[model samples]
Target: MSDDLKEFESDFATLAKLAVQQSEEDVRLLLGRLVRKYRQRHPELAEQLNLSLKSIQTRSGSGALRRESLSEQAPGAGVPLDRDSRLELLKEFDDRGGMSVPLLPSGLLRQVESIIQERQARETLLARGLAPTRSAILVGPPGLGKTMSARWIASRLGKPLWVLDLTTVMSSMLGKTGANLRAALDYAKRHSAILLLDEIDSIAKRRSDESDIGELKRLVTVILQEVDHWPDTGLLLAATNHPELIDPALWRRFDAELRFSAPDTELTVQAVRRFLGPDTEALGQWIDTIATSLKGRSLSDVERAVTTLRRGHALRHAPDEELVSAMVGADLGMKSKVERLTLAVEMAKAGKHTHQEISRLTGVARDTIRKHAGPSPRRGRGMK
Candidate 1:
């Protein structure tokens, strides 16, 4: 057997032996000490193992360390294994396994690297007398890469990203929501995983507007307290599309605010070139023109316009000018004459009215309207 496997086997044997002789408290104490020793000796291995050490101090019980058992009451029971637990502990030793590392695109790599360095610097500050900042808020419109950056950070830090599952975590049971959140926070703290709270504005909105202010206040209080006392070993990342709508108090908890604004003309062109190739040169110029025309539009808008243009081009086998015109017109807030026709077509497709009804309402051609409607999933379904 390999050295690592031999070592793990030896450790497991020792635990089993101790469990047989020692009291439950003694076994737990012994296990904790062994875990600490292992961590000190092989920090990297310990991290790879993803072992969580929780002290189970309760009334008298069996001293035996139950192997591969699942109990909600057991300390640190809900912590997920780094690998599938179906394989016996001994089998896991033979099976090579490792965590997947996330890859960030070249354009965003430097920014994510800087965030890691900033986190390290904060750790150094905490080593001295100064208190390090505990939280960060990533603000960006949809699909501008906020979530991607957060995932990259977690991977780089060798931490699991515990995405806050509001649906599962939120409970209608009286007083249970708060307790569940607290348990989750405690679990996060124990495991040293990055607690990523995406769409934070949904939960942390301004309390003044809430009809049930008490519940909102309590939830916010728990969040703030957790942020305040979060260990320096892990990072906390929160993201929001609507930063302005978030509570003002929520801003104070975060150490840094990273704003991912819409890409400039140059960046947008680069992104398009990267995603699509040199064949999209004319499309890129059109995009640059569109970007200039719509200064305040988001990256999402640019992407959607490009997707629609590509789809339409493929459907109609159209030339560059026709495709670009269709794309630009379909985009919101554009003043092109074709834009009105595109809007009417979209409204009609959405079940508002038929083409004849649309034409009667807006004085546009039913055939022309049908042309702009593009591929209809509803029509395909109907044909089927």
Candidate 2:
């Protein structure tokens, strides 16, 4: 009986704290449910509890469960500047989020580094008659670290990053989208934060196309006006996958334009080793082979492949030799079971696994494995 009482009290205390922190309606509903259940069997206790709730509600004017006005139940949660609005247009971020900047090709990395240096030496640049690079457009395929570059720039400048939500800012309500965009830009100015308009192609597509609508043209013009007259204190950054779809004049507005591409085999190989750390140094030969096979793939692809390989090895789901053999077979893109099993058997033969284990690993019968491995006889001469 005592344990039951303690558990009930503990549950009530936790719910009460949650109610205070989150919503008052939770407390009202909880107490009401308890009172209704006990009213028939314990009349006096139920009455007392109801009276206590009434007293508490009367004590707090804002605690009443009155219906809200239509204005309170309206569409379009206000822009990020509104204090009462729930949605955030800008996702604020700091350096400690632990997302490492991705490896880039040489020319791209050099341009990004120059941008970082220019931002770091703002005063020095002004003294030397060179202006600080405040605006830039990163154009590339997806997963090339365009968004990461924006955050890295923010971190290096010791500033917070506010990436705008294009979904919320772009509205079908006629001219309201431009107003929302302006409001977001105004909010960014207050904190001197890095404002990343990621995927800018959605809004600033090429306005010269005959099939384009007037609203898109107007939106691009608004962007142009804002970019030209934007304040010097805050940084404005934009990124896109389809740079060709963006207006040509808009390209000229940016101080620096950085183009990104998929990493080559050499960089991918180095990235794979660096990502794997000291765990695979002894397997350097196999690691280099992984690099050679992953040519023409992006850095993001390499990260995913390496992560899967390391995790499979760490989890002990399969032995290291077996896992490496399977991954190499997959990376090599073998088309059928015969080719795949042949490769696996060859890999296992090169490694330490025996013939029976190699047969089991490759999902082939041992006799069939021997037939494929053994030299083919002169079939027509031997039979006919």
List residue ranges in candidate 1 displaced over 4 A. Answer: 1-112, 120-133, 165-174, 204-211, 277-295, 312-316, 332-384
Model 1 is weakest, by summed lDDT over 10 consecutive residues, at 87-96
TM-score per candidate, chains pooled: 0.54, 0.61
Q: Estimate every model's Cα lDDT from 0 to 1.
A: 0.56, 0.65
lDDT per residue as tens, model 2, 167-283 = 555533435666666677765654455788877887754345555567777777878876775544457888888887788898899888989887876787778887787666645
The clash numbers for all candidates, in the given order, read: 0, 0
lDDT of 1: 0.56
Per residue, candidate 1 scores C-alpha lDDT tens digits across 285-315 of: 4444344433345555555666666676567
Cα lDDT for residue 344, candidate 1: 58
Off by over 4 Å in 2: 1-86, 96-101, 171-174, 204-212, 328-384
